[model samples]
Target: MELKTRMDGQVAVITGGAQGIGASTGRIMAELGATVVLADVNEDGANATAEAINADGGTAVGVRYDAFDKDAVRGLITDVAGRFGHLDILHNNVGGSWPDRDLQVLDIDDDTWLKIFDWNMHTTHWATTAVLPIMLEQGKGSIVNTITGGAQVGMSIQVAYGSAKGAVSSYTRYVAVQYGRRGIRCNAVNPGLILTPHAVEVMSEDFKRSLFDQITTVRAGVPDDIGYAVAFLASDAAGYINGEAITVAGGGPRSSHDAEALRVGAYGPSVPAPPADLILPDLH
Candidate 1:
């Protein structure tokens, strides 16, 4: 009973809660007895997600929300707090870059590169700002931001997304320090390559194999892997943990570009060829 009620009476706002990591996070939180708002621009998906949770005897509501709109996000937060009597968590999970548009820094167009910030950092700032006053008034709250693992390490083909998320990570620490004594905590989770449904449908075997080459676990990350991580961080269980970035990736760095011939400075490092047993497969 205690396990199922870990988040009992808490209110959690999960942006992008219609699917993928967002949905999984909501489901787990609901199972723990928290009231979840599955806010997403995809109304149908959000409704479906909420219905599933409600059917399972959990408290949840779906709202058509666009995190990019400052007023809309503010209104959502206000409405949720007024209804729930208080807000306890904000899981900032709304952000993604178009794979087709995301390219090398020099190759990406101005509009495409800038849009990445709108989808990532801008939304995080807007959502966090909206929730601050509410949490402050309540005397406690947690913000779990979803940042990309490539933010600090850098993602070659996804430079724009990585850079924007890097800003989010920095902002997470800033918020943490700013609100620590005020009873609010802010942190970020850096997800490695989580293969959501869209990835499962679109990624080819070769593409997935290449992605797995860098991980020591040699297994693809799934959405549920991220769900549990966010739950713990958003709960009081992590009261002392603030201004940190938790990496949920299976471990290992993306070192393919380090082959020396791929690119200069960009490739990161060069290692002398290893012995037969120490040799790793050539990643494409």
Candidate 2:
């Protein structure tokens, strides 16, 4: 018996595909033989990404997407299905947190909270609803949502953003349970400290260092780390996976290091070193 991960003959639409993780996912899916559509609010960026994919011998197209506009969302999905004849994958990757505005809970205003929800949760709901009909008709489809670690863990800031993403996480399960019988699978990917261009520009050195101190992996995650995960979820390879959120954060925090120290204070005193004569097996 053989296992397959290739997405041959599939048509994939990736929202927010202008750059960062969405663009990377588009490139990866295209490489796996899917005809990828890079849909984004940044039309030029999407076109540039699509052109690059095409130049690399993959099938891809760029289109404008306005996640906040319900009609636009529906129109995008309808247009893609009509043009490609079938839409096999829908990656809802349009989301962001306005760090400046997304302060602690009380500091965040009503408008900011609503905006965060619209960006993170509403967009996902709209896209999923728009694509479900086409997917139901085909009797098979995959939907992957981009969530965030902030939603799963306790965070000091970005309360609204994290809360909105938490809603998305729940929505992922709802879609999977409701449509799994119809051959529709929905899941989410939670990214942690990925060094995308926007992240690099916005994340301060202090913040980066704080995150690095807690991260288990030696280096920060790149867009490809998440792109590959999304590709796998969108492919036949992850057909059995549904309603789950996978963290692509380079293994998250180390159990006994920075995070634990922060949680429980420093070792009572300088902890005594192991006995000098103690022998340890070379597991390596």
Candidate 3:
């Protein structure tokens, strides 16, 4: 017998569903017969995603809104529930931080920090709060937040982003602990470097090739990797999995011991050093 996905008749609201993992997850959810609403500030990207899903005979809708606006977030939740009659899944894929000047903690201006905070953490809170009532009324729901590997081990440049994502990781557990009895499941997914259209713009081919060198899998993660994980956690198959932080990096970074082994010739394999280890999962 063939196994099937368990999202039939469900409705999912995915923020930043226009590109990358969010787009992939939205498509995956729709393929499983879920009504997906693609919400993003980028109207064009959202419409494109909706078009692809519709073309594939899946149900989808596109909505445009700035995630930082609490009112907009609340309205989105209300609209999705009203239109679909029920809401079952929520994917919080928004949040990004930069190390650029005026955004750093020491020298960064107040507005910049606040903006980053709002973008990375506040948006997630707003979206979650807005949907809580509906989820409570239904007595069952799943929420997945996107986090960063940098937050797990701490990277130098992405201070704000890491801090924001760290909060998400913690909040995932908090949500799960507080609401598990209420039948609401919350989890976080930390994605390694994924090759999205946006990423391709900033990364060179050689740079990407270098990133694959350090991982045990010798491959970088794609959007599908994260999407598939979210799908599993959102379904009844993962009914028992709540408050978990699933790292979606492929064969994450190697430990210093492995590096030393390779250095000391104990490991016969001569591995090519990747140009960038940032893209590798947190195997380290």
Candidate 4:
């Protein structure tokens, strides 16, 4: 039995749909026949993304939404469902690291720590909680959360972001377990070293090199990689893949020591070659 990825009769609400993976995912969902609702704090960017989708012959609408505000989130959900008559998919994709402020727990102040949590975890909670009733009433829905590599693995540098995302990862599973019997499915995507426009602009050469060395692929991940994963999880084909986390990272994690060694060209003395007289076995 083949399940089509095209969502002709479905409507999708993407929270971070202004740019990067959010924009890419919106385009994909729209292209697949979904009526895409792009919600973002960046009104201009969201409108641009939606306009582009419309130009490409896809259905989309852009609106201002701040996921941290519970009341506003409810209104956004209501507006989207009201317009389309049904809400089928939601990509909880709003999150960003606090520059210079994403610090180790000991180094961070209470204000900064709380801010990061509000940015990452609180937004997810607001959106998911607001959407649950609608999904329950609809009797079917899918949610895809955007988490971080720091949370997936362990990194001491971004303690606050990592901790918040860890909470979201757990929340993802909780939603799945609590609602799977009710026809609601939830999953998360952990992106590693994706080269979004903002990353390209802000990442220093040293930082990029460090991450590139950690990933097996010479190139970094792009927004489309994550977009495709989100689309798949939202589709009926992935009905059984609930409460799971798909790491769209290019490869397995490399040891930090190895990455540093390669970065600094500090490999220890090379091992000597075997004697020429030694005959190697060939039992093929």
Measured against the true structure, the TM-scores of the candidates, in listed sequence, are 0.87, 0.89, 0.89, 0.88
Model 2: colliding residue pairs: none
Model 1: per-residue lDDT, tens digit, 1-284? Answer: 34533898999999999999999999999988899999999999999999999999999999998766778977888889899889999999999998888988788899988778888998888889989998998888999999987876766698889999999999999999999899999998889878788877787866765655566563567888899899989987787899998998877455775422322334445323333232222211
- Candidate 1 residue pairs that clash: none
Give Cα distance to truth, residue 198, candidate 1, Å: 0.4
Write the number of the candidate with greater lDDT, choosing between 3 and 4: 4
Across 198-248, the per-residue lDDT of candidate 4 in tens digits comes to: 777787866765665576554567788899999999998898999999998
| Candidate models: Cα lDDT each | 0.84, 0.86, 0.82, 0.83
Error of 4 at 117 (Å): 1.3
Candidate 4, residue 151: Cα displacement in angstroms equals 0.8
Q: Residues 204-244, candidate 2, lDDT per residue (tens digit)?
A: 75666666545645567778889999998888889899999
lDDT of 4 at 272: 30
Candidates 2 and 3 compared: the better one by lDDT is 2
Angstrom error of the Cα, residue 187, model 1: value is: 0.8
Q: Residue 200: error of model 2 in Å?
A: 2.0
Write down the lDDT that model 2 would get: 0.86
